[model samples]
Target: MQYELAPMEGITGYIYRNAYVKYFGGMDRYYTPFIASTGLNHKELNDVLPEHNAAFMLGEEENAGSGETPPPRLVPQILTNRAEDFLAIADRLRQMGYSHVNLNLGCPSGTVASRGRGAGFLGVPRQLDAFLEEIYKKCPLSVSVKTRIGVADMEDWEELLGIYGKYPVEEVIIHPRIQRDFYKQPIRWEGVELALQQWERTGSGIPICYNGEIHSLAEYQALRQRFPQIRRVMLGRGVLKNPFLVKQLGQWENRLQATGDAGDENVREPETNEDNRGKQSSEYCGIGGYRESEAGTAREQRRKVLWAFHQELLDGYRKIMSGDQNALFKMKELWAYFGESFPGKEKALKKIRKAVSMAQYEAAVREVFYSKS
Candidate 1:
């Protein structure tokens, strides 16, 4: 089974990916946040440049001295509604050494959807169909698509799937949400089931991958029970609460399959209230941290790893980012998910959110990690 880290803008940049890889490496593929292709997008382009992603690059011997590497597991993702735009972006990345890219038809932001990009394209299936046809006809790099089921409902999903089947799409990663639902709806497993049935019914031979609210081992087990044929799993924001989730899932995959068990005893089912996002982020990397049942060494390791990862992220961002504000903006985005894990740091978290400068942000961070409970 292959495990992937889903690309989330602002949350999974090269610094974040590199730090996560350094401490807890389990993801088979780490997708970069989507790069916009239609207009001047220097920021996104710079984010995926070879120098920023050196750790995920190939070894010196394997890469033949070019900054480019072989077909990368560290995949770059592109967002555009125009076929010409996609081709242009693909060629640029190909020149930079990447051989693969993922099309972003899954972003649910209002601004993106309003522009007829991302999931809004799903509302216009004919145009999307034509766009796919043109891109596949001329795109230089291998193309995969990350998409939602439909715009507002599943009424047109069968037709949409048929359009996808008509193309030579390398893979389809389904998030099972419509534009209206965004990430609020508990994942509709039936959506993926429909894709599986359609793929089989048409003998499309296209691979299907599942992505959604997989917060705990029980949720993952239920997904596997429902779709055992699926071999690829991509984790998204839930990893923030438990950075070691991929590692844990990898270790327990075989045991769960052999025993036909529902979940790991050490892991608890996360609350299903998507509105309360902080509740999804946990204290111990989801490994029963600080629990009495766990060994002293295990607790010590958790502390050491989490602290080191935090320091690395803070230090790395400061080094690469121009002004303190940019790094502060990025770190604050992370703490929105991470602050929940530091149980006794509510006031400190507030300070972090309202922080105006690096000094204020770092002071709040120190309080959250070091202040007395």
Candidate 2:
């Protein structure tokens, strides 16, 4: 199964992607936050800079290095309603060495949707069709789309999927929620099933990737069981909540492969018993039973990895931003998701969130890690 790191507006920037790869790498693709179409400004250019997007190479040796995995593939995502602007941006990205670009039609922010951008474009099927037609004709690089089911009504997905089928896009990422639902409501799996059915019936040959509330390996396994043909999936908040999620899922697949259980279907059925759902893999189990020592060591390693990632983010932000406030702002946004990994640390996270200076922020980070460890 292919796993993608979903683009998050204020969170999944180049710095975060690099840090995540350097620490706990498993995601197959990492998407940059949406670069809105305002021509090509300095800020936008900085986001897709080839130097910043390249995989992080480890070790000092010229040819030989530790057996660490390479960084995930990076895909630049752009947000634009106008075909002309999209083609321009695509040309720029292609010139910068990106072979593929993703069009953002899934963002549900009111300001964006109000401007007839993002998910709002879903409200106008004819305009969307025209936009795709022009871009597909003129774009130099491969294009993919990320979209919600519709603007307001779930019924609108039928027409929307048909419009998507009309284009030769790389892939269509379905989030299974309408613009009005945002992230609050339970994901409309019915809508997702409908999309799969429609895509299959149309024989579009364009792959469909599901994205929504998948937080654990068991959830992913269940999703695979429900839709065995799905070969790709995108994770946003869940990955941020648990940095080890992708790694764990990948390891699970590897174990299955070793046992010859991973066949053409690509996933084995998970144990259905609720008690076994949360159990650790047998590879980590001790002779007597659960390996507390091994589990403890792994947890400690993860803590150190998270600390290293935090320091990298802090250092990277300091190098780019001009002041403590700017660095503090970015760090706080990160802690919003990073803090989820550490439960019962409300006070520590609150300190990090309320920090007004770099010194305070550094101290709070140390406190959070130290307390957790």
Candidate 3:
């Protein structure tokens, strides 16, 4: 029942990670938003500063020594096509005391794909294989790769996994969909199932972490029941939409009973539940046992998580905006992914999107959250 936080560019960062850990609390590996490795030099230091906008916020402890504890297992993910560039940033991260790095091959953003950096690289397996060989040869830390099933079609995955199985990567996080589908289709579970069977048969030893379209505890439990071999899962938009999903997945039946006595005698716990017992929220920092009830209780918990996230965003935004009023634009991007968490958030986000200054933006957020309907 191990869980890893999925990286969403311009969305999940240190601020989000800090708030998530403080509240909902069920992430084992926290991945930073992907860092682009196109430009390489000390001149670009501020662009990836651990204290600034970068996803890893270790600089605060590295320099300020605030005695504040670090978040759970923060790992920086890098996006690049050049082998040398990947090695260079890997060296930089090692210098920053990071032990493991994740390569991004799952990003479907048109810009990244157009550059043959993300899913696009899957179409060129030999090139990607060469790139990894060079990277692993010089890399100073352990490496993992987050990738989709294929670039444009299901047929592309066989070659992609073939390339992956040949490497000694720490783990292969797979989202069961082709790149062009872009989340519009149901997850290609069959594709993932095939990969799992092959991995087991080959005894690759590389762990396979499932990802994509997992929205609830039931869904996760069902998957585990069907494939008892899969051990790890990565939560993406599901965690954003329902912060308690991973926590609930481990004790879904008990939660169902706690929420409001379930009467269905047929609702029984699967055999896989015991295997996933360690994944309970209780295991993560001892925070567990939230019963899912009517939507009211759910909304309250959502509000609490959102409040913590909002406060962290405000703090991070202020630091980024200081001496640089232009830095405020970044806040708009933050709202694009997180605003949906707030009640009536769509309207608020729309208003904030058009705001020209901090004052206007504040008014917009207030109107959506504080104004009487």
Please, what is the whole-model Cα lDDT of each candidate in the order they appear? 0.78, 0.77, 0.68
TM-score of each model, in listed order: 0.87, 0.86, 0.74
Q: Candidate order by TM-score, highest to lowest?
A: 1, 2, 3
What's the lDDT for candidate 1?
A: 0.78
Best by TM-score: 1
User: Candidate 3, residues 40-83: lDDT per residue as tens digits?
Assistant: 44423443456543334432235346676445567778889999
Residue 25 shift from truth in candidate 3, angstroms: 2.8
Model 2: residues with Cα > 4 Å off, grouped in runs? 56-71, 260-294
State residue 278's C-alpha deviation in candidate 2, in Å.
19
lDDT of 3 at 296: 48
- Candidate 1: list runs displaced more than 4 Å: 38-40, 57-72, 257-292, 344-347
The CA-based lDDT of model 2 is what? Answer: 0.77
Residue-level lDDT of model 1, residues 1-373, one tens digit each, is: 7888999888898889889888887776789899885553776777778887776642223655778634336788988898898998888887777778899999999999989999988999999999999999998778889999988898888889999999889889999998889889867767898999999888998888889988666667778878999988889876876686676676568666678664566544432223233532333332322232456577558767877898899999999889989999989989887664555446777999999999998888877665643
Tens digit of per-residue lDDT, candidate 2, span 283-356: 32211111223556655666677778788988998898898799899889877866766544456778998889
